[model samples]
Target: MNNINKNQLFWASCLALLVTSLSFGIRAGILGKLGTDFQLTTAELGTITATAFWGFPLAVVIGGFIVDVIGMKKLLVMAFLFHLLGIVLTIFAQGYWTLFISTLLIGIANGTVEAACNPLVATIYSDNKTTKLNHFHLWFPGGIFLGTLIVILFNSLGLSWQIQVAVMIIPTLVYGYLFSKLEFPVTERVASGVSTSTMYKSVTSPLFIFMFICMFGTAITELFTGQWIDVLLKNVTDNAILILTLTTGVMVIGRGLAKPVVHRFSPQGVLLISAILSALGLYLLSTLTGNSIFFAAFIFGLGVCYFWPTMLGFVAENIPKSGALGLNLMGGAGMFAVSVYTIFMGGFYDKLILQKLPEGANEVDYLNATPGSEMADALNLAKNAAGPEILQATLIVPIILTIGFLGLVIYMRSKKTNLIISK
Candidate 1:
């Protein structure tokens, strides 16, 4: 620890996260274009997007097991290879299968970054894991804000979507270079000489199980909504990029100030508050519109900003013996939930559109109602109606999360009190 260049490793990890975030931003930006070019249904598009998440669990869980054996550098190299190949394949993709395979590869790479870096950061900053992790996560939202601006700029300049995707390659290469020669420390579990069986037991503990379930709800609330922002708000707002930028911008600031927040509320307390705020935000998004959407977005962003990092922090602080595997499972579980919700939400949107369509008229008929416009008006109207219904349905997730986190907070407080009394 004394010899390690902590700053370099930390920044390198941030760059890797930036690559992941930029990919997300670019993909969200081009969803409509991809759908139009490929002639896909909403569910099919969601399937493609969801494919990016499928590979995460496979890579992270496996990487977690091997990270101590094969070393973190090997995982970083694997991430780079997959990212490069995935981007190239995505660029050349002409249909569903090709895009799906390409995105799956990128998702694996994204998981690899987290597998390597999350433990890496936690290991280095043992004394300040939560605060440092929160700072580390600032890049996710910050990179998204930058990527959204780039895409919006390219659109204004009549550039292609391919150009927007190409931007990720720069950060990917930069991070790979930064991590090339850095020395990685051993994971906390390994350093502490915790037995493998003990590590495994930590993950299977009751508290871990409870938190794992909550991870699904929090992930669905944040990522599922984030992935669909453009499609959902297209009819209600012409400034989708602006909205995305604003939301992520809020997240960046919120994470930047997370240290003080953590100090005041405690991690579990913050989580409980976040769940309540997220539920409120989703409800407001379902009911509110026009200029009011921005206000609701701000609240929603604030709510989700602390969720991912704080959840990981909880595992790191409380489940120290679970080690990298625990972190890996938490991340993998969250992403897997997002994958399920993406497809489910896509189908839900399609169902709402079908319900809104006039009797005896299918989706094709409504889309082809006017020749030159190419169903633009019809599509807008459908989105406007379907968007609110989707938000309302999604509200169920955070409400569940609120109840779960509330239980956790009470349990943790009682546990702390017991420890103090025993001491």
Candidate 2:
């Protein structure tokens, strides 16, 4: 049995994730500011946000292969440095290129944290992989709650956005200190002496392939909605920030309760139910308005709360031989999906605005219009017209995911029966 301090490592991991989540929240809050200050079009802003996921897959994939070789401590040190550097770059960003590069660095750091810590936690708590992973992932939404609260607080105080970004430095430093001098156990795959060739083969197997494809849809459902929530709800509701906070707040509670849910429903069953809820939630968000928006967001939050961690948990439990690389690839795939979808959604919004605008109106003039001005009013009108269509388009992803998970549930049930008979 491993003798290291699991609690310290777990909390340290949570702090690291907290930093990532804070970064995400702060970035979401600043998107409007970025567009205003930089005079960026909606599509340009989308490209910038997409940059946040661009480097993630590369870092996680590379980190997964070498994590066991360099150890978690070293990977974490790299994460700290990248995060620090990325924040500095973001604070000083002057234009699209600078913001893109800065966000990409942060993406790499976020991916490294996921790559190192998921397996670290799985290794430390091997017996309850799914439940523990759910507990570990609680920090994600928890941090979002804190970060959104900070934004709401800071905005009320009239502080600069830089101050909001700077607040993340505190948690980053704390996590760095916690990780320092701590020993990390080898990955379960390495400990079991599973050769790398076998690991490679496991990822290529048909089941893994199916899950990988489903991950794309699941990620699009959760992340595309999340990253664009503020923008999507800007004109629809006055409480966009609170709505964002409330959404993540619901996620925090749901993830905290995941242990019992997993005990009752099996991971596959839980995923199936989550998929159905997610699809329904998205459809509601696309079609409904007024007081019902909160209800839709609540359902969406409950649906996605378990997605990222649960997907990782399923792989950890079902495909133990695939090791850290498997977890890394799963994370990488999700972020990659988000990256593509962000840009696509941005373009979609841009196209819709053009369609809604009156003949001979200038797109650039509307895009760069100051808030409360006539041009800005026209732009908001176009956004209101187009927003529902964009959201409806996003619903396709979750609907597909619902069907896929239903099939997986049936397959797993049959597999379990055969194993019971063999026993």
For lDDT, the strongest prediction is: 2
Local accuracy by lDDT, each model? 0.87, 0.88
| Model 2 misplaced stretches (Cα beyond 4 Å) | 1-3
Which prediction has the highest TM-score against the true structure?
A: 2
For model 2 the local lDDT of residue 156 reads 88
The segments of candidate 1 whose C-alpha lies over 4 angstroms from its true place after superposition are: 365-376
Candidate 1 lDDT tens digits, 1-423: 777899999999999989988888888888888877777788999999998878887788888888877878889989988998898888888888998998999899999998988899899998888889999988988888888888899999999887788878888888888788888788877888999999899999999998888899988898888878888877658866677788889999999999999989999999999999999988877787788988888999999999999999999999888889999899899999899889988988988988876555577555445545646566667767898889899999999888888898899999999999999
Give the Å error, residue 337, model 1: 0.4
Lowest-lDDT window of 10 residues in candidate 1?
A: 365-374
Residue 154, model 2: Cα distance from true site in angstroms: 0.9
Query: For residues 79-158, what per-residue lDDT tens digits would candidate 2 score against the true structure?
Result: 98899999888888899999999999999999999989999999999999999999989888888788888988998899
- TM accuracy, model 1: 0.97
Q: How well does candidate 1 score on lDDT at residue 403? A: 87
